[model samples]
Target: MVKTNAMRMLDKAKIEYTTREYEVDEQNLSGSHAADMMGADHGCVFKTLVLKGEKMGYLVCCIPVDGELDLKKVAKAAGDKKVEMIPMKDLQKITGYIRGGCSPIGMKKQFPTFIEESARSYSEIVVSGGLRGQQIALQPQSLIGFVKGRFASLMQD
Candidate 1:
Protein backbone atom coordinates (compact mmCIF):
# COMPACT_ATOMS: atom_id res chain seq x y z
CA MET A 1 0.00 0.00 0.00
CA VAL A 2 1.27 3.45 -0.81
CA LYS A 3 1.84 5.64 2.24
CA THR A 4 -0.08 8.85 2.46
CA ASN A 5 0.96 11.99 4.32
CA ALA A 6 -1.12 10.90 7.28
CA MET A 7 0.47 7.46 7.48
CA ARG A 8 3.91 8.97 7.06
CA MET A 9 3.35 11.32 9.98
CA LEU A 10 2.07 8.51 12.14
CA ASP A 11 5.28 6.64 11.38
CA LYS A 12 7.46 9.64 12.17
CA ALA A 13 5.66 10.12 15.47
CA LYS A 14 6.21 6.43 16.20
CA ILE A 15 2.48 5.99 16.68
CA GLU A 16 1.46 2.47 15.76
CA TYR A 17 -1.51 2.14 13.43
CA THR A 18 -3.10 -0.22 10.93
CA THR A 19 -4.49 0.68 7.53
CA ARG A 20 -7.56 -0.66 5.74
CA GLU A 21 -8.18 -0.28 2.02
CA TYR A 22 -11.53 0.02 0.27
CA GLU A 23 -12.85 0.91 -3.14
CA VAL A 24 -14.08 4.49 -3.39
CA ASP A 25 -17.41 5.33 -4.91
CA GLU A 26 -17.66 8.96 -5.89
CA GLN A 27 -21.44 8.84 -5.67
CA ASN A 28 -21.27 7.73 -2.02
CA LEU A 29 -18.36 9.53 -0.44
CA SER A 30 -19.70 9.62 3.07
CA GLY A 31 -17.70 8.09 5.90
CA SER A 32 -20.52 5.73 6.78
CA HIS A 33 -20.21 4.34 3.29
CA ALA A 34 -16.49 4.02 3.74
CA ALA A 35 -17.04 1.99 6.88
CA ASP A 36 -19.54 -0.20 5.12
CA MET A 37 -17.02 -0.91 2.38
CA MET A 38 -14.37 -1.82 4.90
CA GLY A 39 -16.85 -3.96 6.78
CA ALA A 40 -15.95 -1.93 9.83
CA ASP A 41 -18.12 -1.20 12.80
CA HIS A 42 -19.61 2.24 12.28
CA GLY A 43 -19.05 3.16 15.91
CA CYS A 44 -15.29 2.98 15.46
CA VAL A 45 -15.15 4.85 12.19
CA PHE A 46 -14.77 8.63 12.50
CA LYS A 47 -15.25 11.47 10.06
CA THR A 48 -13.29 14.73 10.15
CA LEU A 49 -15.00 18.10 9.83
CA VAL A 50 -13.37 21.49 9.35
CA LEU A 51 -15.12 24.63 10.47
CA LYS A 52 -14.32 28.31 10.59
CA GLY A 53 -15.01 30.29 13.75
CA GLU A 54 -15.51 33.98 14.19
CA LYS A 55 -12.26 34.40 16.13
CA MET A 56 -10.53 31.07 16.02
CA GLY A 57 -10.01 30.81 12.29
CA TYR A 58 -10.17 27.15 11.32
CA LEU A 59 -10.88 24.25 13.66
CA VAL A 60 -11.68 20.59 13.15
CA CYS A 61 -13.92 17.96 14.68
CA CYS A 62 -13.90 14.16 14.41
CA ILE A 63 -17.20 12.45 14.98
CA PRO A 64 -18.57 8.98 14.30
CA VAL A 65 -19.24 8.11 10.68
CA ASP A 66 -22.97 8.38 11.26
CA GLY A 67 -22.70 11.31 13.67
CA GLU A 68 -23.39 14.98 13.17
CA LEU A 69 -21.16 17.82 14.28
CA ASP A 70 -22.72 20.26 16.71
CA LEU A 71 -21.51 23.59 15.43
CA LYS A 72 -22.40 25.49 18.57
CA LYS A 73 -20.72 23.00 20.85
CA VAL A 74 -17.55 22.80 18.75
CA ALA A 75 -17.24 26.55 18.58
CA LYS A 76 -17.50 26.75 22.36
CA ALA A 77 -14.86 24.07 22.76
CA ALA A 78 -12.55 26.06 20.51
CA GLY A 79 -13.21 29.24 22.53
CA ASP A 80 -15.14 30.80 19.69
CA LYS A 81 -18.69 32.21 19.77
CA LYS A 82 -19.85 30.44 16.62
CA VAL A 83 -18.64 28.30 13.72
CA GLU A 84 -19.56 27.25 10.21
CA MET A 85 -18.34 24.59 7.80
CA ILE A 86 -15.64 25.55 5.36
CA PRO A 87 -16.86 25.65 1.79
CA MET A 88 -16.05 22.54 -0.26
CA LYS A 89 -14.11 24.40 -2.94
CA ASP A 90 -11.70 25.78 -0.34
CA LEU A 91 -11.02 22.48 1.36
CA GLN A 92 -8.07 21.40 -0.78
CA LYS A 93 -6.49 24.81 -1.05
CA ILE A 94 -6.82 25.43 2.68
CA THR A 95 -6.00 22.00 4.10
CA GLY A 96 -4.09 20.33 1.25
CA TYR A 97 -6.83 17.70 1.20
CA ILE A 98 -9.96 17.16 -0.82
CA ARG A 99 -13.30 15.94 0.45
CA GLY A 100 -13.67 12.17 1.11
CA GLY A 101 -9.94 12.03 1.83
CA CYS A 102 -9.03 14.69 4.42
CA SER A 103 -7.30 13.38 7.52
CA PRO A 104 -7.07 15.11 10.91
CA ILE A 105 -3.43 14.06 11.23
CA GLY A 106 -1.73 16.18 8.60
CA MET A 107 -3.04 19.33 6.99
CA LYS A 108 -1.56 22.42 5.39
CA LYS A 109 -1.55 23.81 8.90
CA GLN A 110 -2.34 22.40 12.30
CA PHE A 111 -5.75 23.65 13.31
CA PRO A 112 -7.37 23.16 16.69
CA THR A 113 -9.25 19.85 16.56
CA PHE A 114 -11.89 18.08 18.61
CA ILE A 115 -12.99 14.45 18.64
CA GLU A 116 -16.39 13.57 20.02
CA GLU A 117 -16.02 12.19 23.53
CA SER A 118 -17.66 8.97 22.48
CA ALA A 119 -14.39 8.04 20.77
CA ARG A 120 -12.89 7.51 24.20
CA SER A 121 -15.05 4.47 24.73
CA TYR A 122 -13.19 2.56 22.07
CA SER A 123 -9.57 1.44 22.34
CA GLU A 124 -9.08 2.31 18.69
CA ILE A 125 -10.89 4.16 15.95
CA VAL A 126 -10.68 4.43 12.16
CA VAL A 127 -10.08 7.72 10.36
CA SER A 128 -9.31 8.74 6.83
CA GLY A 129 -5.87 7.63 5.66
CA GLY A 130 -5.30 10.92 3.82
CA LEU A 131 -6.87 9.51 0.69
CA ARG A 132 -10.11 8.14 -0.51
CA GLY A 133 -10.22 4.32 -0.32
CA GLN A 134 -7.77 4.22 2.57
CA GLN A 135 -8.21 4.23 6.36
CA ILE A 136 -5.99 4.32 9.39
CA ALA A 137 -6.94 2.63 12.65
CA LEU A 138 -5.24 3.58 15.87
CA GLN A 139 -5.92 4.34 19.50
CA PRO A 140 -8.16 7.35 20.01
CA GLN A 141 -5.77 9.09 22.38
CA SER A 142 -2.84 8.61 20.05
CA LEU A 143 -4.71 10.17 17.15
CA ILE A 144 -6.00 13.05 19.28
CA GLY A 145 -2.61 13.74 20.83
CA PHE A 146 -0.89 13.59 17.45
CA VAL A 147 -3.25 16.25 16.17
CA LYS A 148 -3.15 18.23 19.42
CA GLY A 149 -6.89 17.84 19.61
CA ARG A 150 -9.27 17.49 22.53
CA PHE A 151 -12.11 15.12 23.15
CA ALA A 152 -15.38 16.98 23.59
CA SER A 153 -19.12 16.86 23.10
CA LEU A 154 -19.12 17.61 19.38
CA MET A 155 -22.00 15.46 18.23
CA GLN A 156 -25.25 17.24 17.51
CA ASP A 157 -28.12 16.77 19.94
Candidate 2:
Protein backbone atom coordinates (compact mmCIF):
# COMPACT_ATOMS: atom_id res chain seq x y z
CA MET A 1 0.00 0.00 0.00
CA VAL A 2 1.17 3.51 -0.81
CA LYS A 3 2.03 5.67 2.17
CA THR A 4 0.21 8.95 2.06
CA ASN A 5 1.32 12.09 3.85
CA ALA A 6 -1.20 11.37 6.59
CA MET A 7 0.19 7.92 7.27
CA ARG A 8 3.73 9.21 7.29
CA MET A 9 2.85 11.99 9.66
CA LEU A 10 1.21 9.56 12.02
CA ASP A 11 4.28 7.34 11.88
CA LYS A 12 6.56 10.24 12.68
CA ALA A 13 4.35 11.17 15.59
CA LYS A 14 4.53 7.62 16.96
CA ILE A 15 0.81 7.18 16.58
CA GLU A 16 -0.62 3.73 15.95
CA TYR A 17 -3.10 3.29 13.15
CA THR A 18 -4.44 0.67 10.76
CA THR A 19 -5.20 1.18 7.11
CA ARG A 20 -8.18 -0.21 5.24
CA GLU A 21 -8.52 -0.17 1.48
CA TYR A 22 -11.57 -0.40 -0.74
CA GLU A 23 -12.50 0.12 -4.36
CA VAL A 24 -13.15 3.76 -5.18
CA ASP A 25 -16.43 4.61 -6.84
CA GLU A 26 -15.88 7.86 -8.66
CA GLN A 27 -19.60 8.40 -9.17
CA ASN A 28 -20.30 8.06 -5.45
CA LEU A 29 -17.39 9.03 -3.25
CA SER A 30 -19.50 9.53 -0.18
CA GLY A 31 -18.08 8.59 3.21
CA SER A 32 -20.96 6.19 3.88
CA HIS A 33 -20.19 4.34 0.67
CA ALA A 34 -16.55 4.08 1.62
CA ALA A 35 -17.52 2.76 5.04
CA ASP A 36 -19.84 0.19 3.49
CA MET A 37 -17.11 -0.97 1.12
CA MET A 38 -14.78 -1.43 4.04
CA GLY A 39 -17.44 -3.15 6.14
CA ALA A 40 -17.01 -0.45 8.78
CA ASP A 41 -19.60 1.37 10.81
CA HIS A 42 -20.71 4.59 9.15
CA GLY A 43 -20.97 6.39 12.50
CA CYS A 44 -17.29 5.77 13.10
CA VAL A 45 -16.22 6.85 9.63
CA PHE A 46 -15.53 10.53 9.19
CA LYS A 47 -15.29 12.84 6.23
CA THR A 48 -13.02 15.88 6.23
CA LEU A 49 -14.63 19.10 5.20
CA VAL A 50 -12.82 22.35 4.39
CA LEU A 51 -14.61 25.53 5.23
CA LYS A 52 -13.79 29.22 4.92
CA GLY A 53 -14.42 31.25 8.01
CA GLU A 54 -14.96 34.98 7.71
CA LYS A 55 -12.22 35.75 10.21
CA MET A 56 -10.17 32.59 10.46
CA GLY A 57 -9.71 32.01 6.74
CA TYR A 58 -9.60 28.23 6.29
CA LEU A 59 -10.71 25.68 8.85
CA VAL A 60 -11.05 21.90 8.70
CA CYS A 61 -14.07 20.09 10.12
CA CYS A 62 -14.27 16.32 10.60
CA ILE A 63 -17.64 14.77 11.22
CA PRO A 64 -19.20 11.33 11.06
CA VAL A 65 -20.35 10.01 7.69
CA ASP A 66 -23.91 9.62 8.94
CA GLY A 67 -24.21 13.22 10.16
CA GLU A 68 -24.43 16.64 8.61
CA LEU A 69 -22.23 19.56 9.64
CA ASP A 70 -24.08 22.28 11.51
CA LEU A 71 -22.69 25.51 10.09
CA LYS A 72 -23.90 27.64 12.98
CA LYS A 73 -22.25 25.41 15.54
CA VAL A 74 -19.13 25.27 13.45
CA ALA A 75 -18.97 29.03 13.24
CA LYS A 76 -19.41 29.36 17.00
CA ALA A 77 -16.74 26.79 17.66
CA ALA A 78 -14.44 28.51 15.21
CA GLY A 79 -15.12 31.88 16.80
CA ASP A 80 -16.16 33.21 13.43
CA LYS A 81 -19.33 35.01 12.55
CA LYS A 82 -19.92 32.84 9.54
CA VAL A 83 -18.41 29.84 7.82
CA GLU A 84 -19.06 28.23 4.46
CA MET A 85 -17.75 25.17 2.72
CA ILE A 86 -14.98 25.82 0.31
CA PRO A 87 -15.71 25.33 -3.35
CA MET A 88 -14.64 22.01 -4.86
CA LYS A 89 -12.43 23.82 -7.35
CA ASP A 90 -10.52 25.47 -4.49
CA LEU A 91 -10.12 22.38 -2.32
CA GLN A 92 -6.98 21.06 -3.98
CA LYS A 93 -5.29 24.42 -4.16
CA ILE A 94 -6.18 25.17 -0.56
CA THR A 95 -5.60 21.85 1.18
CA GLY A 96 -3.53 19.86 -1.33
CA TYR A 97 -6.23 17.18 -1.41
CA ILE A 98 -9.11 16.40 -3.74
CA ARG A 99 -12.83 16.09 -3.00
CA GLY A 100 -13.07 12.54 -1.66
CA GLY A 101 -9.51 12.30 -0.37
CA CYS A 102 -9.18 15.25 1.99
CA SER A 103 -7.79 14.27 5.36
CA PRO A 104 -7.71 16.45 8.47
CA ILE A 105 -4.11 15.44 8.87
CA GLY A 106 -1.25 16.38 6.52
CA MET A 107 -2.85 19.22 4.71
CA LYS A 108 -0.75 21.74 2.73
CA LYS A 109 -0.89 23.92 5.82
CA GLN A 110 -2.14 23.17 9.33
CA PHE A 111 -5.42 24.92 9.50
CA PRO A 112 -7.41 25.05 12.72
CA THR A 113 -9.28 21.73 12.92
CA PHE A 114 -12.41 20.62 14.73
CA ILE A 115 -13.79 17.10 15.10
CA GLU A 116 -17.33 16.20 16.05
CA GLU A 117 -17.87 15.67 19.78
CA SER A 118 -19.54 12.34 19.09
CA ALA A 119 -16.19 10.92 18.09
CA ARG A 120 -15.10 11.10 21.72
CA SER A 121 -17.38 8.14 22.42
CA TYR A 122 -15.34 5.90 20.14
CA SER A 123 -12.00 4.36 20.95
CA GLU A 124 -11.01 4.72 17.33
CA ILE A 125 -12.48 6.46 14.32
CA VAL A 126 -11.82 6.09 10.60
CA VAL A 127 -10.75 8.99 8.43
CA SER A 128 -9.52 9.33 4.88
CA GLY A 129 -5.94 8.26 4.40
CA GLY A 130 -5.19 11.22 2.13
CA LEU A 131 -6.47 9.35 -0.90
CA ARG A 132 -9.53 7.71 -2.25
CA GLY A 133 -10.18 4.04 -1.46
CA GLN A 134 -8.06 4.26 1.67
CA GLN A 135 -8.82 4.96 5.32
CA ILE A 136 -6.84 5.28 8.51
CA ALA A 137 -8.27 4.06 11.80
CA LEU A 138 -6.78 5.49 14.99
CA GLN A 139 -7.69 6.62 18.47
CA PRO A 140 -9.83 9.73 18.37
CA GLN A 141 -7.89 11.57 21.07
CA SER A 142 -4.62 10.74 19.37
CA LEU A 143 -5.93 12.12 16.12
CA ILE A 144 -7.23 15.24 17.81
CA GLY A 145 -3.86 15.82 19.42
CA PHE A 146 -1.95 15.15 16.23
CA VAL A 147 -4.05 17.65 14.32
CA LYS A 148 -4.38 20.13 17.21
CA GLY A 149 -8.12 19.66 16.94
CA ARG A 150 -10.83 20.23 19.51
CA PHE A 151 -14.09 18.36 19.93
CA ALA A 152 -17.15 20.36 19.03
CA SER A 153 -20.81 19.82 18.40
CA LEU A 154 -20.77 19.92 14.61
CA MET A 155 -23.62 17.63 13.72
CA GLN A 156 -26.87 18.84 12.29
CA ASP A 157 -30.34 17.56 13.29
Off by over 4 Å in 1: none
Q: Give all candidates' CA lDDT scores.
A: 0.93, 0.95
Colliding pairs, model 2 = none
Tens-digit per-residue lDDT, 69-126, candidate 1? 8888888898899899999999999899989999998899999989999999999999
Instruction: Write the residue-wise lDDT of candidate 2 on 8-123 in tens digits.
Output: 99999999999999999999999999999999988899999999999999999999998999999999999999999998999999999999999999999999999999999999
In TM-score terms, candidate 2 sits at 0.98
Worst 10 residues of 2 by lDDT: 61-70
Candidate 1 minimal-lDDT segment of 10 residues? 68-77
TM-score of each: 0.98, 0.98
**TM-score of structure candidate 1:** 0.98
Looking at model 2, residue 24 earns an lDDT score of 96
User: lDDT of candidate 2 vs native?
Assistant: 0.95
